[model samples]
Target: MKQITILVPDGQSTLSSVACIVGAYEVLMSANAYWKDVGRDEPFNIILAGVSKKAAFDNGLLTVKTQANIADISQTHLIIIPSLIRDFQEATKGNKLLRDWIAQQYQNGAELASMCTGTFMLASAGLLDGKNCATHWSAADTFRNLFPKVKLQPEKLITDENGIYTNGGGYSFLNLMIYLVEKYYDRQTAIYCSKIFQIEIDRQSQSAFTIFTGQKLHGDEMVQQAQAYIESQLHEKISVEDLSARFAVGRRNFDRRFIKATGNTPLEYTQRVKIESAKKALETTRKNINEVMYEVGYADIKAFREVFRKITGMSPLEYRAKYNKEAIV
Candidate 1:
């Protein structure tokens, strides 16, 4: 039988972390039971392993008893790292032993998966270097800053490269779990599990759910001014040349500084800001698509629809139907 080990990391558990650990354990166990019901022997031996025998959470209000210690588990078919709650740097530092063990296990031919912010642990273990990874969209900036070598795809619901798997923010890890089931078992079993869990399967993108609050934390006063100007003038057609001239910087230098600070060119940033505003208006108002488009300063309907779909993974009408209840009527 193949062994699946879920690491119970030592830390203060938030709701997301606790849910991921428990949810993963339950889902895999359900799959194993289903496998047995179908006249196959229990194909997986699921184990919850940790650096210690017990990991406390929520200030000792809850304690998880791990089934095996990492040191005792010489080989496993797969390892699932749960979502983390602490600061990424501190969490990585405190879990050095677990990180090293994860790297070693991967070297021993075990597949690795990280749930949400658990990508941090895998990146720290050096397993994700040069690999494509998906994590919570809110952590994209920090993850990029910390692990510049890893390709971060925050818009994706799941990423699978080589033996590593990662999923986007919150509860979306359920989709990754289903994907793994399909990979290890069969399509029928994965579909059955999805039905049981009521999770939508084959979800390819998380773009529709992302809220693109501009990345303004980088300490560039000039870029900050440019960002502010772009946001303030969303109702007007703004160009990079106009912005550069207004800020008293050359166009090439301004573009470079904006990309370095926000990870987007000035034009890309402008599009995102405009589309974000359109998304909000679609979600909250009874206005028609054209009115929303004009409100965001786009006169061309085709151009507006294209940009909206490009950023949101859905057309404006579809987005409204999904998000705005009144619009449905």
Candidate 2:
């Protein structure tokens, strides 16, 4: 049987961490039970291993006693890192020993998977230096700032690269668990677990769930002014050339600085701002799709729909039908 070690992170969000750890455990155990029900034997031995014997959360309201200490477990088939909901810098600092162990285990041939912001710990351990990774969309800017080397794919529901796996934020980790079930067991077992969990299988993107508020914390005064200008001029079709001239910077220089500060080109940033405005209007108003598009400064319906779908992974009508009950009616 393959032994799976789910780390009980030292500084974790109580509910999120518990849900991820317990959810993964239940799903994998369910898979095992399904195998036993058939002619096959169980395929996994799951363990909750931690650097310490116990970890507390929510002001000591709850405590989890781990099954094994990482110091005692030299090798495992897989290691699961649950979300760290505390201050990421502090959480990563407090769990240095755990991070080191994870790095060592990866070197020893154990595959790694992180749920939500748990990817922070993996990145801290230098495990994702040049690999592709996905985390909660809200943390994309911060993740990019902290680990510039890791290709942050905030839009992806799950990212699998060279044995390491990561998933987007919140309960989307359930999708990652399903992906793992398919990998470790078989497709049939994965389908069975998905049915029992009621989680949609083969979920590929979290783009529609992302709220693009723009990355403003990069400490660039000029870029900040440009972003404010973009947000304030939503009704106007703003051009990068005009913006560059208004900011008194060359177009090429403006684009370079904007990308460095916001992780997006100026044009991409403008489109995102426009599309985000359209999304809000679609969700909260009775406006038709063309009306919303024109209100957001897109005169061409095809161009607006294409940009909306490119950024959001859904057409305007589809997004509205899914998010707005009134629209469905």
Candidate 3:
């Protein structure tokens, strides 16, 4: 049987960490038994490994008993890392030992998989330094700031490098587990587990769920002014030249600084802001497509539709139908 060890952070475990590790064991165990009863081979030896013999979760509301301390398991086929709470930094302060253990396991030929913010731990362990990884879209800025070398693909629901795997934010971890089940066992078994768990299988992107908030946390005053001006003028056509002149900065310098600070060029940022506004209006109000486009300062219907689709991966009418039934016409 393949040794599939689920690593829970003993220092500061989240409920998700406890739940994901345990849930995987339950689902995989069910799959193994189902396969065996149906005359198939058992595929996994599920092990719950922790940094300590027991770990407390949710400020000591619950304590989990680990099957083995991480040090006891010198070798395994795969190591699963569950996400901490929203802030990876909060739990990582006392997690050096856990991080080192993870790195050592990877070096010892064990594959790695992380869920949501758990990718932070993997990144911290330097396993994701030069790999493409997925995390919560909300953490895109911080993740980019901390690990510039790692290609952060927040839109992707899962990323598979040589043996290192990462997934997008939140409950999407269930889908990641299903993906692994398909890989290690069979697609039919994964489908069986998906039905049992009521998890939608083969969900590939988190982009549709992302609401672009216009990142302005980089502490660039000039860029912030430009962003504020763009947002305030949502009903007006915004040009980079106008913004540069208003900010008293040269066009090239403004473009460079804007991209550096916001991770988007001036035009791209304005388009995102406008599209986000259009999305909200579609979600919350009763407005036709053309009316909404005009309200957001896009006079050309084709341009507005293309920009909305480019950012959201769907047309305006489709977005409205998906998000708001009352507004659907």
- Number of clashing residue pairs in every model? 0, 0, 0
Over 4 Å off, model 1: none
Top model by TM-score, which number? 2
TM-score of each: 0.96, 0.98, 0.93
Model 2, 1-329: lDDT tens per residue?
Answer: 67999999876465789888889888988999999999899988988989788888778877878999999997899999988874788888888889999999999999999999999999998889999999999999898888999989888989999889999979988999999999999999999999998999999999999999999889999999999999999989998999999999999999999999999999999999999999999999989988998899999999998999999999999999999998778
Q: Which residue segments of model 3 deviate by more than 4 Å?
A: none
Task: Go through the candidates in order and give each one's C-alpha lDDT.
Answer: 0.90, 0.91, 0.86
Hey, what RMSD does candidate 2 come out at? 1.1
Question: How many clashing residue pairs, candidate 2?
Answer: 0
Q: Which runs in model 2 stand beyond 4 Å of their true positions? A: none
- Writing each residue's lDDT as its tens digit, candidate 1 over 1-329 gives 88999899977346677788888888899899998998988888999999888888888877888999999999999899888874999889888888999999899899999999999999988889999999998898888788888988878989999999999968898898898888888888899999999989899888999999888778899999999999999999998999999999999999999988887899989999999999999999999999999989899999999999998999999999999999889
Enumerate residue pairs that collide in model 2. Answer: none
Flag the better candidate by lDDT, 1 or 3: 1
What's the CA error at residue 195 for candidate 2, in Å?
0.4
Quote model 2's TM-score.
0.98
